[model samples]
Structures are given as structure tokens and as C-alpha cells.
Target: MKLRYWLAALPFIGIYSGGTLAASTTFLFGLPFLLVWNLIWMAATAAILAIIYCLDTRDEAAHAGAGKGVEK
Candidate 1:
């Protein structure tokens, strides 16, 4: 139900679409369209996961005082 869950699903959707994307024989920067799709998805997956990780770390970041030295 969270935003990250929806974002995670996006990359999987791209995976399933590989077959349909492969139908295109277009070459991109000397690489096939399918290869380009896979490369883009790879970066997308990392970015999506990084977002999830940042979301997950919010609680840890909120407890900022716990790891700090006593100021008093």
C-alpha cells in the first residue's frame, strides 16, 4: 500500500514487457533495443531500491539523538 511498493512493481512490469520490447529491431548507440531496455531497467531498479532504502532509514534518522554525544 506504500508508495515504495508501487515503485517496486514498476520494474517488474518492465521485465514482463521485455518480449514485446524485443519485437522492435531498432539499434540504440550500437545496442539492440532489448539491451537498452534491460540497461535502463537496471538503473531504474537501483534507483527504486535506493528510494525504498531511504524511506526505510527515516526512522533511524529520526532517532538522531541516540547516536550523538551528550551535549549537557
Candidate 2:
């Protein structure tokens, strides 16, 4: 949905591409890049998840406060 999402995907895409390349080329350096790429991707994913969690919590709190002022 956002550019951040697309940017976040790049590391994972690199990992997959690197892995495929490694299998065929069998290069030592390629393996390290793959591992690093995956690790970076995982970190990015964690950050995104944390942001989503915070946003949800904020929304819930806002709704609760708003509800207190309304009467049916």
C-alpha cells in the first residue's frame, strides 16, 4: 500500500535472488549477502509490526475516550 512496504520487500527479494544465484554459482560471497539480506528484512518486518501495534493501540484508546462522551 505504501512505499515503505515496497522498500521493505527489497531485502527479502534480494535474499531469494541471491539464494538462487548461490545455488548455481556456488560463490562464497553470495551466501553471506543472502544471510545479511534476510536478517535486514526480518528487522524491517519487526519494525513495521511494532508500528502497526502502536497505531492499533492508539486507535483503541481514542475510541474508548470518545465513547465515554456519547449517550444512547
Candidate 3:
């Protein structure tokens, strides 16, 4: 994994810690705090994974193009 992938995963670390460290006396829009927080983080993780996929695919295309002239 690259540094960018590791950095992208930082939010997950924060989400896990936040769920454990925070008090349970709060609510968001009638939902429990952790429930809302977990849902938001899940969406964020999905978005980050999508971005990583895009980056990986772009890099693959670039490498394929660069290798085309040498393969003959």
C-alpha cells in the first residue's frame, strides 16, 4: 500500500476511537450519537475507496501507455 492509501484510512482510525472515547449521552436527529457517527463514517470510507480505485485505474492506464512502444 502507498502513503496515500494509509493517509486515506486515517478517518477510520478516528471513527473507531471516537466511538469508544465519546460519551453516550448525546443524540443526533433522534438517533444515538454513535449510530449517526458510524453511518457517516461508513459513507466516508466508501467515498475514499472509490477515490483510491480511480487513482489506481489511472495509474494502470498510464503505465500501459508507457510500455506500449517498448513491447515490439
Candidate 3 colliding pairs: none
Of 1 and 2, which scores higher on TM-score? 1
Clashing residue pairs in all predictions, respectively, total 0, 0, 0
> How do the predictions measure up, each by TM-score?
0.71, 0.42, 0.64
Q: Per-residue lDDT tens digits of candidate 3, residues 20-55?
A: 745856888998888888888888888777777776
> How far out, in Å, is residue 43 in model 3?
0.3
Q: What is the C-alpha lDDT of each candidate?
A: 0.85, 0.63, 0.77
TM for candidate 3 is 0.64
Error of 2 at 26 (Å): 10
Candidate 2 lDDT tens digits, 1-72:
865566567655655665665444433445565566567667866786676555456577888899898889
Over 4 Å off in model 1, which ranges?
Answer: 57-72
Q: Please list the residue runs of candidate 3 whose C-alpha ends up more than 4 Å from where it truly belongs after superposition.
A: 1-3, 57-72
Off by over 4 Å in 2: 1-31, 57-72
